[model samples]
Target: MSATEYARAVAFGHAFARRQAVRTVDVPGGFAVLDDEFDQVHDLNRLIGTGPVTAGELIAAADTVFGTAGLAYRQLTMDGPTGTELVAGLTDAGYRADRELLMAYHGGELPEGVPVSVVEPATLLDPAERAWRAEAPGLADGTYRQLARQRLRRPAELTRRLAVLGADGTPRAWCELYLSPDDRVAQIEDLLTLPAYRGHGYGSALVAAGVAQARTAGCDLTFLRVEADDGPVGLYRRLGFEPLGEARQFHRAAGGT
Candidate 1:
């Protein structure tokens, strides 16, 4: 795919993430309280709103539940580089910037003849689950277990779908697709490739699978964020994903009193 097309696909991925985040909110605690609906490529963080003080307070509260309890976490969204205070707040706490991504999309001919199958967690393989677990370092063990529980119990609240391509057996790589409440978009929740499987077009194939799922769900767009400094920016660039915006994160670890 050309750079333009790649960028567009990535943007679609981001939109999907945003919409899924908005839809999957559980209210009172889960997603609704955080109000991550507006998060975009330029502003990846999802924690913002009402008053500045309220926003900070909300972050602190989230720290207790999402952070400490490990049931969830926060992703703050800013238009560009964060302010000194924000940086200090995050650093003093424990949180630091994670994925700085170039967001882009337009939509057209995807990589030719990429095979895709969208399967739910129930239909997926344990190896695929392990691959995603290995990729998300920030995800706590409790949270990971809870995800499995939610999928088994409250399947609606958790949409765990995967995209696979390449050789029929053993598979190549897979991507997770999250379906939100509104059903407007599908979040490419997470993408994973076994260490040995990297660089073999598996990632792009996963991206294609996500797009197909999102469109099938009646969603118009999809989305995700990448580290601005990550070398793969070129890969995303070549794929058509462009820089749409930026976000900053702050965290305080247990050491902070």
Candidate 2:
């Protein structure tokens, strides 16, 4: 990763945690984000940051935090050398690992398809269930719903909740655009479109809307994060996004997946 890309990723993650976590506790390497009320919402409750610490020490610190908070699972994502090096140790200790990519706009702009409007996260729930479950069929119904609903906990004004609604007023596609122009970055997160409605290009339209809006807001760069192997990477590339860097995620499910 270039220093610029790496720094952007780290800065966004740190800023996001500080603003969203119910409570953040200091620990070796970085900090533990705790939010018992969210029922293990990984983004709101996980270990973040990377300095230097053994996998054993990292796991111990994370477990202590979750245990004290009565959380049933644990998640940690580190986008640095310390995290990259801990992959083997974490997997050996039975944690599931995921590789994620940080991408930035390079040039592909989609043709305008649909108009998107600001809306509450809940407004997209019906279509989201159809879209997300098809993309991540492995997650249980309740888990997927909970994951999507996690955004609702935040103040509605935090991010621009953009969506393309169906004829009946339900959103057919949705996403969140968080503009932090002072940081010179605008993050477009969690893009989803209903399964049956996808071929019509709702996904690309959402991306276009976000990119145009973010740039209009004076953000120097627009970025998105997703698992390295996710299918949407192709679509995003078609819309001008290219790989910036990588991040590693180590997680243990409630019953230890």
Candidate 3:
């Protein structure tokens, strides 16, 4: 069958990971992304896809690769499951899966009536503090901060960061827009807003700014991926983004759980 838009977009994501991963090794169906520097950043330290291999072999390889690095866990990212056997096998093996939805912008107006500007990724730290506390209340203040910092550390030579700043000059909302090497695809990632600032229209404003930037770059496809049942799905739909695909990520947090 011909590849769906979602499949093409998934390929684009894997290509990006391969292009920037500090180290990569061929695995059964695809490869593993290994960046010890961001070991805790699961996306930077997980398997990128799956193929026609037995679940036991896949789990063993993943454990070895990650375990050898002292990461203590195995994680896998793949487009939605194709067969029940593998999915059932992995589930029985104790790997938990989470669904992530990908949506594509279908050309339209967005409520950017608010001001959103391109900003240094470093500048968002102030606004991100609230996120650290709200999202991971049990984590050490430093750990949450560290996680946020690590995300910004990703390869960004092809990215533009956008933010909506309050009158006091602190970011109320922010997101990252990444244009593909050929400028044909743009993926809006890491959209965030502080807990106390939720209703200020910052999210839509930031998205609008990102879409504008994508159009300016002549990117033919603009998309955003978020966890299923996430709050922003409705907002994205209202802004003209339609479902393109979904990814199912299997995670076994440190020590086979």
lDDT tens readout by residue for model 2, 1-257 = 45686678568768876787779899888898776667646888888856777888888888898889888788887875544458888887779998888888877646684778888767766666666677678877677777767777654445888998877788877888888767777888888777667788888888888989988889777888878875577877888889888877889888667
> How many steric clashes between backbone atoms does each model show?
43, 2, 0
Please name the candidate that would achieve the greatest TM-score relative to the true structure.
Answer: 3
| Tens-digit lDDT string for candidate 1 (35-89) | 2322211123244321243334545655553443233435543334445675656
Candidate 3 matches the true fold with a TM-score of: 0.91
Per-residue lDDT tens digits for candidate 3, residues 162-230, read: 888889878878888888748488899888887778898888888888888888888878888988865
Alpha carbon lDDT of each predicted model? 0.50, 0.78, 0.78
Residue 95 Cα positional deviation in candidate 1, in Å, after optimal superposition: 3.5
Model 3 pairs in collision: none
Q: Give me the overall lDDT of model 2.
A: 0.78
Candidate 2, clashing residue pairs?
108-239, 108-240
Alpha-carbon deviation at 28 in model 3, angstroms: 0.7
